[model samples]
Target: MLNKFTTKIVSLSTLNNYSFIIPTYQRPYVWGEEQIKKLLDDVLLSFTTNKESIYYISTFLTKEVGDKAELIDGQQRFTTLWLIALVLSEMTSNNSEISTFLKKGDELRLSFEIRDEIKNYLKALLKKESTSKFLNEHFIKKHPYLENIAEALSTIKGYFLQLSEDYNLNEFGNYIYTNVKLVKNTTPTNTDLNKLFTTINSAGIQLEQTDIIKARLLNLIKDEKIKFSRIWESCENMNNYFERNVRQAFPNWKSFNFKKPFDFNDNLFQHNEDVIVTNPKDIFSIDDLLEHDYETVNINTDIKSNQTEEINENEVYCRSIINFSQLLLHTYRIHLFKEGKTDFPEEFHSKNCIAIFNEMIKRNNTEEIKRFFKLLWKVRFVFDIYIIKWVTNIENKTEQLELMNINSNTDGYYSRTKYEPSSNLMLQSMLYFTGDYLRQYWLTPYLNYLLQDFDNVAPTNNSHLEYLEKMDNIISTRGGKSEKELSFEYLKTNEFTQQRLDIEYFNMHLGTGFKHYWFQKLEYILWKNWKDREEKNFKNYRITSRNSVEHIYPQNPENRIQHPEIENKHLHCFGNLVLLSVAQNSEYSNKSVSVKKSMFGEKKHTYDTLKSFYIFQSNQWTPKEIEEHKSEMINLLKMHYEKTFF
Candidate 1:
């Protein structure tokens, strides 16, 4: 097994000796700010903890094509690494070590096959002195295919700029070049590359850490291993509802009754009827667990047909905010907190979850392992019912945060209705965008709240919305507070202490430096209090993953003579800025105020930020209007804060 493939661990610095090609069949660069930020942050954490220690990135599978290697997998991470090197070169003077991996002489070390424009873009990026100038010149011209690459570059630049002065970039770059390592697994010459790519994408050939954890837990209870495995498999499919997962995984369990979509009872896991075991052997390995797939059984043919047809017509195209690993951590944290343990971690990091759980199970008895899985089932059920998912429309490809209402028919079959934008959705979207993308701290407290006496809690009551509103207030005004101070226990007993909202303080921050929280929070405020005739404009509005801040009045107006009265002081203040997606921000680049105003009106959907809609609604954008709008927006935030929390 080990003779045919050549495998070796190589550092970023050693990659300077090799060239790679991204085949045309590969997807375009699709890593967004969330992904780029997570990779950089993970590396930075390793660098800070111990610069001398080696940080092992994942493996890369490639085939040797002449002197160049064709990337079969790991293209996204590889492209991101190259972009990091590019950003580091631009920001610092002594970047020879980093630049060597980016290029060899005049030729780039990485190239896209048959993508001439992308190749030219990469070359131009190397020659330009500043990434910002290159992005402005090329991205503003509307290369729709390269938007992800451009957005990634922009995110990398901003991430480095915001680092504290104490952290030396030169040292960090040196660490990245020398200490960060990836395993390179090169395929043999006779291997069929096409079949390899298809197999890698369509199937899971390698065992994950989660699978090992499941194996370890199941090994503890030999008598109930089948039951535990079913629980684990059901919880793993985060995209589907828990009721459906349970039905599919435990098809032979006749006592199970999904009376409602959110009905999760502890007794539901007991084997009231005899369950057919496909593999009855007592000694099963991790590979056996990984290979096992549950056989689907139709409960009611008539209801199942109707459900299938309805789902196919209006498919709920949605993605979970957190993955299965993070879900495990969330469920585990709640478990420990309920047991009156205080040593658990406050933040969720997927890299650390395995080690944390290993330590946890080390101290647990067999009974404890069974209890954990039972709790996981319940937590996942409540999660699907109460949390917001990134739901997209099939026809338009436009996405919004949606809390879907689960509907049940007379035969007790469950289906989901189309989502309508509500306060619960808006509030969660605000938190989702404003907080750390990798670690959702808000979920710990919110999920814990829903799980309390969960069997008795009504999913239709307004209590869920009220609890989220209070949590938002606490999170918003939590200025420099520690996580311990904002724990679930603290949320249960505390009311928000009103803080003075300073208009002048907010006015001082300018440009991209302005906090995005204010802009997003204002959108929620506007939507809640909206009574205007333009109700259609905002009725369907929801917060999205926005990072770029756009200036309503162009900083360098394309037609310079249009709005000269706006002074530098009022130019970049809160009133002039709106949080927008990267594509929308580039599309409105440097246009005159009137041109921007016209573009806003022509669009059928609502503005990304409702504040922008109101700002552009004015007849003119002079200094006087900026000052008045600034004051008015601040007053709205101030009043809303006071009313909601105090």
Candidate 2:
């Protein structure tokens, strides 16, 4: 069986039924901040460097017993990249070349089930059915956050448009279509890309079983022979169990780890005062259960597998996390269902997940699933921490003790639980301990909560109790903030997770720190600000586009740019260039830079303070001047820091 094939980049209209299979058991789509930033940066860079439409195709192999490729990896990268494409489409839809690609891409691609899934997901994300709708839905005309991202992409797209004005994009597209490149593997071979992706992403996080369940659900969604109703019902017990027991009864419980144990304090419930912790049985309507149409969800057993082989452990781990996420979601749904509300869907948003996975399922681009895994891993522990705190708080409660004394040693609170490592390797043990304690901290209490609803009976059906001893062993080694700090450290070292974080924290916040870098890189403002080349005059005005932090003050003169411009003597002083936008700074042109500061009252001081700080920090400043300005800079920074931190 061949796992690799190479093909040319063809017209969007030509690629038909060449399914992009994301396995049901693949990890959920997630991208770290940095990886996302890099991807966006790459696209932007490409617009500056690569002239023709650059197409890249990545491929992966599954060890699972199927040909259907569930998005085991690369979901976030795909989604974000697609988003960039969408933005490009919107920007150039008016221009013939870009419009041709955008409209054609939409028309040709979105008709595919996978593409529709992505479109619907994007709509949900944008909170609008269409791009035009997004433009109108908000009072600001264009949502600033989204608009910033779009503009970055739009600028790059425009750069390309101008570059290709003479060359026909359609002609280039035709040439590329005729000569596609694939991974070029004939027999099944594990691509190093997938392996590297798995290693980089698998550090602190492991995919969950719930991810697998969602994959199964998606498979069911695509199956025609099996009624969706039957599939729904088959999953009802599982769904209802999660919802009633987890999402609603324990609103904070989202992930499953067996080490960090949980304990339920039922006595905390006060008939006259406190919130009632209801049972799963009470929450799920019996009428709905009895009348629930299972006929709609039964997926065909013989449904074609997009996967051609068995999925490896990495793939399994990935799918499991997605399944786990769905489980949390269902649990939340159950919470809502208890209140007689239909707040969310039951199908696990398969279309959206699948679509994202499809766009990102490439050999070199496993960053998406890696992100999902990290979050899945982090969230699991976060929930665990919450449960532990919840249980500890309950045990110490005076009101609860009046009803029952449920300490950590009590039946539901199994303090005597044993521990065993699945692997004896030190690293493995640490991972186990980390995962186990974290799991116990959250899962045990969840079970206890369920048991409390069933007359304080401990969990008999759940696997959690059986593993209590192993959890106990791992918990013995549990340290304080050390464990959490270590987890974060592990995450930081993880390339995929880190990259996804960059996208989340940096690229997404482009108007924040990221745009500053852009301004520096482009140097558009320096040209506009400085007009004269100098040597003889020794002009009191200092002019330099040395890529220094945009300073508010001039170097040579102590008088601020805010002081009235005194002709050539005070030209290009600190006040004029300090608060200028990047473009303005570039435009000042080093010529006569004499400009008076605006009398904006309090705002002026803020600008002055900021400008003063920059000047003080300049490496070129004399030691004496730096010392003089240090306290002022410190004060300004201190004030800002206090407000930000405290």
Model 1 deviation from the true structure expressed as Cα RMSD, one decimal place: 5.6
lDDT leader: 1
The TM-scores, one per candidate, come to: 0.84, 0.24
Instruction: After superposing candidate 2 on the true structure, give the runs of residues whose Cα lies further than 4 Å from its correct spot.
Output: 1-14, 18-57, 60-69, 80-167, 171-200, 203-646
RMSD to the hidden true structure, all candidates: 5.6, 22.4
Give the per-residue lDDT digits (tens) of candidate 2, residues 263-381.
32223211221323211121222122223432222222221212233222321000111233343443433333333434332122322344333322332223333333223333333
Error of 1 at 10 (Å): 2.9
Write candidate 1's Cα lDDT for 521-581 as tens digits: 8888887777773577676566777767788888888786775756678887887888887
Model 1, which residues run further than 4 Å from truth?
Answer: 1-3, 44-54, 64-67, 93-100, 129-144, 158-175, 252-317, 345-347, 453-461, 479-505, 565-567, 644-646
Residue 601 alpha-carbon offset, candidate 2, angstroms: 11
